[model samples]
Target: MPEETFVIAGASLAGAKAAETLREEGFAGRVLLVGDEIERPYERPPLSKGFLLDKEARDKAHVHEADWYDKHNVELRTGTSVASIDRAAHQVTLSTREPISYDRLLLATGASPRRLEVPGSKLQGIHYLRTMADSAALKQALAHGGRRVVVAGAGWIGLETAAAARSYGNEVTVIDPEPTPLHAAMGPELGGVFADLHREHGVILRLDDGVAGFWGAGQVSAVVTSGGAEVPADVVIVGIGVRPNTRLAEEAGLDVSDGVLVDQSLRTSDPDIFAAGDVANAYNPLLGRRIRVEHWANALNGGPAAARAMLGQDVVYDRIPYFFSDQYDLGMEMSGVAAPGEYDEVVYRGDRESREFIAFWLSGGRVVAGMNVNVWDVTGDVQALIRSDRPVDPARLADPKTPLAELA
Candidate 1:
């Protein structure tokens, strides 16, 4: 029998893990992991938190040791991108114009940071955090601090980077059009908590304002807001959001929506193709709807599920969405979906004023999502509550004496 080949594009956390899973599953066929960046696959969470803060070393962010891929007999192609996918030929053309044929293909192309289109965006001082290189550069820029840093967007990335900047003694100003920080993700109620957190830390908040343009001579000097105010900035970090890389799947004639559309098993519209991680808009049975999760947990687990599906296993990628963030002295873990309008009421457990609490988002009296801030050992309980899809008495959920295990 001819040796089967499996090709994984992106070499991201998801793609690299898929390769490892294939070898672990005893697939003796050829495995190729291709990526555009020169560095090997690494975890992204540290880029904004520990790595950016210089609390963690550069090598700590890597998914595996440099020699792991070679020892596992996996073909690692860094600094190489998939230029196009030929579905009929079952092959992908690389940026080097080399063609690699595969029996099964996994597209974990991941995402890129969104760039500002306003004037002076191309200035030298403007930065975006997505890759290891970006983090390293930002760290170097902020390490000596004392610079006027302006962060556009109060989303996760924006706020996290803002925290890092302020920690370095830089005068940080966070500007967002939303009424509060994390308004879209955590809703107005909980978003107010973060707004207060940053405010107490001396970070200026310019809420309900949008960046009209940037003004500077070769480097950004000030951000002009739509509200007709100019805020001086020696350094600018744009963290509006990210966009998934779905070109390869779309060009291959595979289904593509907000991302590559996949089934519960992570299989794409094409039977021979699969997708996971940030680029996959997969149907999650637990959520009863398709969700394209860009969080680290999804990529960490989704890759293995896709690999098993390729191995002819009955796989259902139905894990609840999870993500964590560390800003200032606050550490938080959030499970399930809490997007705006998805939940009716936000219930708090523990002390919100002390910044140590667990907040649950409820929909129709059932726990839809839960976030534990500066709290430990309750992630499982929080997840169980969301998974049980059972209604809980709001009073019991809020009572400090009532255990979360019982409420679920």
Candidate 2:
């Protein structure tokens, strides 16, 4: 008797990782990976970074090159969408009416970029960086020198694209309602450092402002701020954030709160079904709350966790939840979670002035979360220990003379 088929919905990072993991764990099953995208599994982080820098790397975006899936005996289906699921019948209805039965299912549908709802948002030159098509369009709009680009958000995607635009010698302006860029993620002190950096790069920073919409007849040639300031723009990009692509799970009557809610084992309310990646609002043992991490690391780690759980290995899915972003030669790394200034003050390792620093959030005189700029490798042990709330010497944390790993 053959092993039961494992059907996966979505074929991007999380889905592809799950299929690979299943094979690696010696699961002799029929793996059916369904995805709506025609392209193979590719990295999204590179789409905003290296892919933007080097045009040739676009083809290299696929995580698994050509015959890797075949060698693994994984049936990868592209350009196909899963329309519905019959949980009782253990069958999935694809758009093509091809019903496939599965012994297990992994929901890694991820999230979609939220669009700007305005008059001229549908116009040309207004793009959102979510998929290859969006990136390709934005790349074309930003190709020429001296193009007036307006980015309508201070979030990761907007800032990243703004940095890329500035690198390519484009006249860039970033508008956001936040007082400083990354304030939500990095807090005030670090946000100010980021703000200063962007201003230093000659990026026109419009703080505490938002675009009412776009202008021009066919293309978004201008951005009208909330205060009625019309900033001229050759191209407009919106990167407010993404909403979880949880409609399929919700329609299938699966429990969903913000995202498809899953236990620590990455199993959904329905035991046969599992959810991972940006689509899974999982219970965080460290934070003691249900949180959905949108980082690439989550997609990678969570996929394997779900697969392990499905295979009856039963491993606890308590990943460190690390993420990194590089822009304008500055690298930012984060580990663990912060609980609303549970830290009295951020302890520093290096000078923040030079932008080569590690700041740790403290609560009850113990480190909770750590952020390092251009010093990610050193953050490993600190993250592992701090994420577990292991006691550390405050003196060692503040002392540049002391090695952080020593305290860990």
Highest TM-score: give the candidate number. 1
Q: What local lDDT score does residue 301 receive in model 2, on the 0 to 100 scale?
A: 90
TM-score of each: 0.99, 0.96
Model 2, span 263-345: residue lDDT tens: 99999999999999999999878778788999999998999899898898877787767788888978988887653455666
lDDT, candidate 1, 1-408, per-residue tens: 999999999998999999999999999999999999999999999999999998999899899999999999999999999899999999999999999998999999998988889977888889999999999999988999899999999999999999999999999999999998988787889998899999999999999999989999998899999899999999999999999999888888899999999999999999989999999999999999999999999999999999999999999999999989999999999999898989999999989999999999999999999999999989999999999999999999999999888977
Off by over 4 Å in 2: 339-343, 391-393
Question: Which residue pairs in candidate 2 collide?
Answer: none
Please identify model 1 stretches exceeding 4 Å from their true place: none
The 0-to-1 C-alpha lDDT of every candidate, in the order given, reads 0.94, 0.86
Q: Looking at candidate 2, what is the lDDT of residue 204?
A: 94
